[model samples]
Target: MKVAVMGAGAVGCYFAGMLARVGHQVALVGRPQHVEAFNTRGLRLETKAFDETIAVKASTDAAIAADAELVLFCVKSPDTETAGAQLAPHLAPDTLVLSLQNGTDNAERLRTVMAQPVAAAVVYVATEMAGPGHVKHHGRGELVIEPAAGSRDAADALVAAGVPTEISDNVRGELWLKLILNCAYNALSAIAQLPYGKLVEGPGIPEVIAQLVTECKAVAAAEGVTLADDVDSAVRKIVQTMPGQFSSTAQDLARGKPSEIDHLNGFIVARAQAHGLSAPANLTVHALVKLIESKAQ
Candidate 1:
């Protein structure tokens, strides 16, 4: 299948490399640095299983998606509308656009700008761009996507390429689950500049995380999303599962790049406010992260 990865960041490059490894024609649309590197040296994928460069097409223009049958929209939350607009003029009528993004509502936002069918996927991959054209995968490469017209075939294709894929009727719930996890950790990690282990060791940190999780769950419930009963346990298990791993927000702050706190904790705060509630814990962390980002700038 011909595939196009819009916004070839870590997640985009990793999945594109996987498809390319399976001999799928893949084009990565990204920054000029990554595009140039991939065009010259191929995409370097450092996975838990192997480390190698995979040959793929690379371009900085969204027009590269014109001929693709499957398009993975992987832009960050802030770039969702802008990137969607850029791809709107070029999308094929039959193209399957899946939003492989962080926060929820991205697919809905895309549909507002484009006539293309858009599906949302809960991506459970831990990956980062080590360098230009190099994606380092820490662990877990699986996707839980919403069922749509072409989703079954897309899931099969992804599974055949070694990525575990599932079609779920409640993808919104899955997205909220991931969002709750992000709210529980991302901002705290960013504000402290600490990994899961050390971050959990601070005094009163557990209580703070509990408060965040409670507020996020209330917001999710108010929004009519059914989260898992063990969501709190899941949030706490991250410290044990990846003790040394820093949240993506932490990595972004350390790199002097903008973090996604606005969509994580800030999103909870916004939704809670709309529902006539407040999320003090999420609000505090979100504000602190914004302060740190402002200072960094």
Candidate 2:
């Protein structure tokens, strides 16, 4: 498969390298420096199992995706439309656009901007850009994608590349569940710049998490998202599963980069307004992150 990673960040480089490793032709479309680095020395893949360099095509221009059969759209939420629009004119009409981004609405937003079919996927991974053209995987890598017209074929190809995927109709529910967890922990983690384990151990942290989860559940229900009954269990599991983890948003903030805070908790707040419901907890988290975001810049 000829694959193009639309945003050559951590997730993009990691997945592109993986596909290239498995003998798929993958091109990473991103920043100029990253492209130069990859073209010079190949993408560095550092994982718990092994570390190696995998050579792949890298480009900054969106037109690099002109020949791609599969487009891995991995930009952050706020840039979804801009990124999609950049590639819109170049994307093939039959390209299977898999949104490997955070937040729930990226696929829909991409569909609107690109005028192409886009599929949503719940990304379950912890990856980071260690250096130019280098991707380091710290943890899980699986996907729960929604049932789109071409999703089965996309999943099969990803699975062939050793990427686990489950195609389902309840992907939105799953995305909301993840969003609930993010609203609860991501801001606090970013603000304190602490790992999940340490953050959860602080006094009143558990209470605040519970409150945030409750607020999210209320907001989701009002928005007609049918979440699983085990929301708290999922929330608690993130700490134990990724105790040493500083969330992506936390890492972004620490790196003085922009976060998708507006798309995560802020999205919840927007949905709350649409439903005529209040989401004080989510709104508070969004506002706090916004304040810190200003300082970060």
For model 2, the stretches where C-alpha displacement exceeds 4 angstroms are: none
Number of backbone-clashing residue pairs for each candidate, in the order shown: 0, 0
lDDT of 2 by residue, 1-297 (tens): 898999999988877887889888988898888899999999999998889999888889988788788889998888899999999898778788989887878888888888667888887777888888888998878888888767888898888877888898898998888788888889989888999899999999999889888888988888789984489899888887778778888988988888999988898889889988888878887898888889966
Residue pairs clashing, model 1:
none
lDDT per residue (tens digit) for residues 94-161 in model 1: 68899998898899999898888899999877788999999998777889989887899889999999
> Once superposed on the true structure, which residue ranges of model 1 sit more than 4 Å away at CA?
none
What residue pairs are clashing in model 2? none
> Model 1 lDDT vs. the true structure?
0.89
Which ten-residue region of model 2 has the weakest summed lDDT?
220-229
Estimated TM-score per prediction?
A: 0.96, 0.95
**TM-score (C-alpha) between model 1 and the true structure:** 0.96
Instruction: Mark the 10 consecutive residues where model 1 has the least summed lDDT.
Output: 228-237
